[model samples]
Target: MRLPLTSRRSHHRSVCVLLSALLCSGLACAQASYRIATEGTYRPWSFKDAQGALQGWDVDIANALCERMKARCEILAQDWDGIIPGLMARKYDMIVASMAITEQRRQRVDFSDKYKDTISRFVAQKGTRQDVSPSALKGKTIGVQRGSIQANYLSQNYKNSDLKFYDTPQAAELDLVAGRVEYILGNMVTYYVGFMKTAESANFAFVGPDLKGGLLGDGNGIAVRKGDVELLSKINAALAAIRADGTYDRITAKYFPFKLM
Candidate 1:
């Protein structure tokens, strides 16, 4: 049955409008949702709790940033060793783990401006009588996390010293407390919040000068794909807003006695 020419034209217009609406909806969904990857083992940064849910300073900060950006965020756990590779493979839109912004890493992925700065220090038993000076630790074994800037720094600067690499700082700390290693190198903030707070670490003391820049990189920042300038800009804006309104300071204070941002 042939329809009138006017009727056919009107029907075609309606179909076109429906298709446009569907496409627009799909695009909006895509823009509103993104995935962020984190290493679930790093305590006080991003780690799973006894309830089996992710919790930490970075987790909270990421949630706040997503809220400010008005975007839906799905936090995924990934191994620390493969984090950068996973981002390059498009497994996640961003890395909110405590990633140091070093030039070597910058070559592989872009990083947002540092939202936090932490000093690296060496820790040992309180009464161990161990001198933490670079010269004093010369032949002693030092433990550091594998694939970490701390490992790079120790290798570069302490060539003559014996180096032991662990998969995580927790492992290295365990070894240090067990007397397997002379000392452990890691962020002072992590040690203070996670390790030093424990009764077992009552005999531990942080030593050495504050480690920064050089192999340690500028500071801790979020990592995104190299061409994700738009997403990076959004995150930076959110971070700036949090800092300007003192939200960042409040978060920092919860974890430490002093401000880190």
Candidate 2:
């Protein structure tokens, strides 16, 4: 009961075609896998949980975008200062570390459309002078994260003030609590959620008016190496898709009570 040679040959060809299709699909999945970088010390944006797993607004947003793109992502915690350099070195495809979209940063890396907006502020002991003017802060000591927009703003405007820069936001907060610094400057939302709301920050309050525009930058964006148009395009598209489908809102709700964008 052997089949005709022609029939057997056709069946064999069909199997070969099926196998080839399956192999191609697998290859496509592997190709889509990407490495993404984030500043794990920045809480409510990107930070490790008690279990040491990265979980925050930025990480969730990155995950949502990857889902829209149908890509597999490996999120890595990178130091803030080295995040861009790592991307340029091809260590990661892009950075989802809530980096601001600024003229200075744009010279080194391209960015996706902003996913969130933010303002900077100064936090000091409740009884301290609330003025953020340069003259008032002239001799005061301020703790700020190194290379941040807050640090830049203070350096340019409050030149007479003493600026103490730290490698991470948490370090700055610790210094502020210990009274080593007269004030601390950082994102309003971060301080409100990560520090202000904490038990240790009970005596501290936001002093300055919300600082926006100028050197503060417009909003937070995902960063990619300069001239990485293809990856930038994909990130922008996925970001748009997630926002339109409500995935972005859902993630934001988990971390913030107010709209960031």
Candidate 3:
């Protein structure tokens, strides 16, 4: 007996599908796919431009790591208010955002080795020089991003001062511009490249010393859910590869004039 043409084609299709699945498992399609979450409101680290597309150092680094790992990566713009909670809900597989590696955060998620540093900075209207100490800022209102190390530092050390925490850095910047706050605490690189150098921020200048380590903990790192140890290891390997092969430097130079990593 001879098979009908339609049946012959159906049998061939099944075999082709099986072969493709086998190939994907072993060869050209071995690359993994991951979804990354970033707080898109932090400019120079991550934010949307006039066209509403995401950009900045975090986006660049995330893409680079995805490439090095041969993985398809999708980045989502999540609000800082619920970023960590979203991760716990399995909304994303990783966080390539400029999240600091603090002990408190480690209890919930695992982090790759420090891929970048975090330096706190204080900015105010030009010629406004405060000592950046409890005595200097006493009774003054300072602006900080809520749930950030800067906010934590202010609450812990400058208890005498009134600290205003915003959901995003841009909101804090707005308050600073409107004279709602005496000073703004933020990331050093961002305060310089994303704001102070711009014409609108011409009236603003950095005051006090660059801060690191203490309450800020270690540097920035990519974060994964706790127990996702295998994925965390792979991310660290990609980070190391990019740094050694000059990919890291190339990306860093595009946004910052100085070495930040």
Runs in model 2 lying further than 4 Å from the true structure: 1-31
Question: What lDDT tens digits, residue by residue, belong to model 3 across residues 144-183?
Answer: 9998888888989999998999998878998899899989
Tens digit of per-residue lDDT, candidate 1, span 94-176:
99998999999999999998988867988987775546666888898999999888999998888878999998999998888
Least accurate 10 contiguous residues by lDDT in model 1: 23-32
TM-score of 3: 0.87
Worst 10 residues of 2 by lDDT: 23-32
What lDDT does the true structure give each of the candidates? Answer: 0.88, 0.90, 0.89
lDDT of 2 by residue, 96-202 (tens): 98888889899999989988897998999998877889999889999999988888888889899999999998999999999899899999999988999899999
TM-score leaderboard ranking: 2, 3, 1
Clashes by residue pair, model 1 = none
User: Roughly what TM-score does model 2 have, to 2 decimal places?
Assistant: 0.91
Candidate 3 accuracy as lDDT = 0.89
* Top-TM-score candidate index: 2
